[model samples]
Target: MEKSLIKPFIAKRVAQEFTDGMVVNLGIGLPVLCTSFLPEGIHVTVHSELGIVGQGPAPDEANADPMHIVDAGGSPSSIVAGGAFTDSAESFGLIRGGHVDAVVLGGLEVDQEGGLANWIIPGKRMPGMGGAMDLLVGAKKVIVAMEHTAKGNPKILKKCRLPYTAINCVNMIVTEMGVMDVTPEGIVLREYNPEFTVEQIQAATEAELIISPDLKPMA
Candidate 1:
């Protein structure tokens, strides 16, 4: 697939995991794109750590509210009808209180033990580990949505080198190359992109993968 098509492909696959009436939190970056690919007839209440609930998609510049409503990433966003806004305290309360069903997060690295490292790279100036720790442990499910590699370096590793955001917290992973579930046995390959064979996908991953008996094409 063309490089330009990868993110959306991963996003579409992540969106498929959501079901009706689920309250989901979308972390900054790639995870936010899942909103654009949600399947029809499935409605999910999107939560932003910035305090917006029932958040909608990015709006056309001309249609955007002059008040500057934005998501947790600070991107201008729209709120669906019946959506309500709350203070950040209340938002964190909801998350820490386990009101969220699932959270989709972007990762820099994920290891065999379901560890994630995304907040920062050592010595690289970063804002902070915004709400990731809370969501990782608070949400019912944690899904990491990211690319298979970074500049040709594998992001899925035998053990994450960077600082972990949460240990043993990830449940599923969706990348342009494949879909995997982090299991006690190991990383299990569930669906793979037909563009790459099983061997090719394994070559791009540093962690060992257990091929699922029901493995099929990603799309």
Candidate 2:
């Protein structure tokens, strides 16, 4: 697929949340795309589960190396000139120790209360939880990026039917339609695309979304 078809806008927004020298972990799939959107001048440090730290931006097409395997996307990447290796044990230790500043991951469903259900599919019985359970508790901040709806059905629900990996773990969610923050009051609408409305988002979501008074169109 062409990169044009990808909604890096949300990725871009999530990347903006990053700061210089912060350690970030990118989950599989869409979250992996966030690396390509990072501003060139920033020296953000990236980490991968495959035991890599001091990771760099996504490589150019001609530069991409599938063997590198920084993230699931197989984007071109670079590591520290002399990096060390650790087993999943040590890798997870970094995650569980709260060393990760933020995590960007995809989601199957997110409830208004910030409950995240990214694994399993009810009667279907899909793959169970992966690192999400640990990341939820480990990462300082969690940003989820996913489509507002999946195959015309709302992924945001009042209650997750498939199964839940974590309850009230997400800090923010950026969908194709809008951006929402899990506030003390509720899921606050932080931003929305130009073509959508609060009612439109509400209609497409099974969960109750609290529209922020400052809700503005996406810039």
Which is the leading candidate under lDDT? 1
Looking at model 2, residue 26 earns an lDDT score of 85
TM-score of each: 0.93, 0.84
Which stretches of candidate 1 lie above 4 Å from their native place?
61-68
Per-candidate Cα lDDT values, in order, are 0.91, 0.78
**Which segments of model 2 are wrong by more than 4 Å?**
1-6, 56-78, 122-125
lDDT tens string, model 1, 1-219?
Answer: 688888888889999999999999998778888878889999899998888889988889997874769877677888899998989899989998999999999999999999999887888857688899899988999999988999999999999999888999999999989999999999999999999999999999999999999999987
Which candidate comes out best when scored by TM-score? 1
Q: Which pairs clash in the backbone of model 1?
A: none
- After aligning candidate 1 to the native by TM-score, how far in Å is the CA of 6 from where it should be? 0.3
- Cα lDDT, model 1, residue 159: 97
lDDT of 2 by residue, 1-219 (tens): 123554676687777778877888888777767777777777566777656676655667777676754553445566665455566788889988998899888888888777888878866867667677888778899898888898879998877776778887889988878888987677888788877778889899887888888989876
Candidate 2 versus truth, CA RMSD in Å, comes to: 3.4
Q: What is the model-wide C-alpha lDDT for candidate 2?
A: 0.78
